[model samples]
Target: MLDLRLAPMAGVSNLPFRLVARECGAGLLTSEEVDARALVQGNAGTRAMLRHLPAERPLAMQLLGSEPEVLAEAARILEAEGADGVDLNMGCPVPKIVAKGHGAALMRDPLGAARALRAMRKAVGVPLTIKIRGGWDERTLNAVAIARLAEDEGVSAITVHPRTRSQQYTGRAPWEVIASVVDAVAIPVIGNGDVGSHADAAAMRTATGCAAVMIGRAALGRPWIFATDAPEREARAAIVRRHCDLIQGHLPERIALVQLKKHLAWYSTGLPGAALARPRLFQARNASEVKAVFWGLW
Candidate 1:
């Protein structure tokens, strides 16, 4: 069994975010879902996403693509670039992505995904894994079948975010499907979605028999979620400051400060007039403005 993992948010899991998640008690972290084609063609933005700090050990670079050749090459590139592992994106169900037959579209084509997994297994020296949903839709639920295929192809692990593609982040993730996946694969299966507290994480393990838990939306502004006893306003200030410093250390001061605006909004929820604070934080263009949004408001 592994530790708590941080999922690769589409636009958020950069070096700074992963560093912040680590400080908040995440065991393993994945970079944002990267486009394999972008890496192969030398996209600077995609390359920049590969940056990491010495303290952040065992970080996996998550890749999103449907082509076996490109995905294999990208996995090779990640191994050469010092990544600890490579995880394929077979679960994303965004319309724009699915239209291209890239994301959860793979759920509809298990044979192709299996073939891609095999190719990537042969291409990379480091550990290879994949993240998948229940299936393209409720009608085609086949997570157990896909899990076996990835395992047969030598994937190190499989992550099951149990919402079907059609559900798309709506409703609760079906932990039962995770149990099915764990039963089907010898490798570790990390559970994902809707875990907001230690109890939720613990329940996920108890209910699904998964080895690890991947925190997504619940981890956004609540990184210290596992550490906080009560997770009230009393804990918000300290977490915000620590995250701000982490961001500052990893990125430009201004970017870090502004980025905290979104997180602050989430942390400040349930407080008196958090609505007022959100607009102010977005309107906050500097550090002093951020301080006011947090300190003055409280």
Candidate 2:
């Protein structure tokens, strides 16, 4: 079977969403980005990102930060808490994140990224991985260079998004960048970006020789993308209900309400009048209200 994994999306790939994706056939789940400094400082919110049910096992937690020492300590905490692996985030293009010298900013300083990876690699016993962009920008397309550097530093695997930070999430993802990284690295390379269906996953592997495919934005509200075939409306409804149940059961009331509104809105994507109904979904004051608005549309 093709290895289809859920990309670690900030604020979206929470426990409930990951469970839904895994149930839909996603492999090797990853958690939302955890802040290395905040995690090491024992921030309650940062620690919450590490929470996982046993069923989500074999999961890796991705860390966001630029400091080697802070990241090393954070990786240690994740390993001690039972993470299957630790992933360094190097592809986030958010302006605030980049301004902090984290995320894709690290791509500009290969030596700094290597040092951080080296520190984290020695800090944890579990597999160490990284998700990187093609480069800092078009002028510096150095994914292959970074992949080779990661392999030399004992990184277990690499995921290439193949878009320069300058491109952010816009424009066509230059998959040839992925192919270049694959040809340049002996370690496994996972391809991400612009893959929305099983067909796209297969095409990525065929085009890039990637060992796996990570689905990001495309999986939003449509976890069934990981399933071998798209489920019927009745089945999709069941999945959506199950997802609602999971969110309610696993998260606090306040957070559950937000997630319920967010995901249920995504679930409403293709239904007639969905565009107009979206406002009501967000206006829902509680889970029951949210469900009422959504199922009314369903």
Q: Return the top candidate by TM-score.
A: 2
- Candidate 1 all-Cα RMSD: 2.2
As for candidate 1, its clashing pairs are: none
TM-scores, each model vs. reference = 0.92, 0.99
What tens digits encode model 1's per-residue C-alpha lDDT throughout 197-239? Answer: 7788889999988998988887776777645354566665666
RMSD to true structure for each model, in Å: 2.2, 0.7
lDDT agreement with native, every candidate: 0.83, 0.94
Model 2 TM-score relative to the real fold: 0.99
Evaluated against the true structure, the overall lDDT of model 2 is 0.94
- lDDT per residue, candidate 2, 124-192, as tens digits? 999999999999998999999999999999999999999999999899999999999999988899999
Error of 2 at 12 (Å): 0.8
> Stretches of candidate 1 above 4 Å error?
228-236, 252-258
RMSD of 2: 0.7
Sliding window of 10 residues with minimal summed lDDT for model 2: 45-54
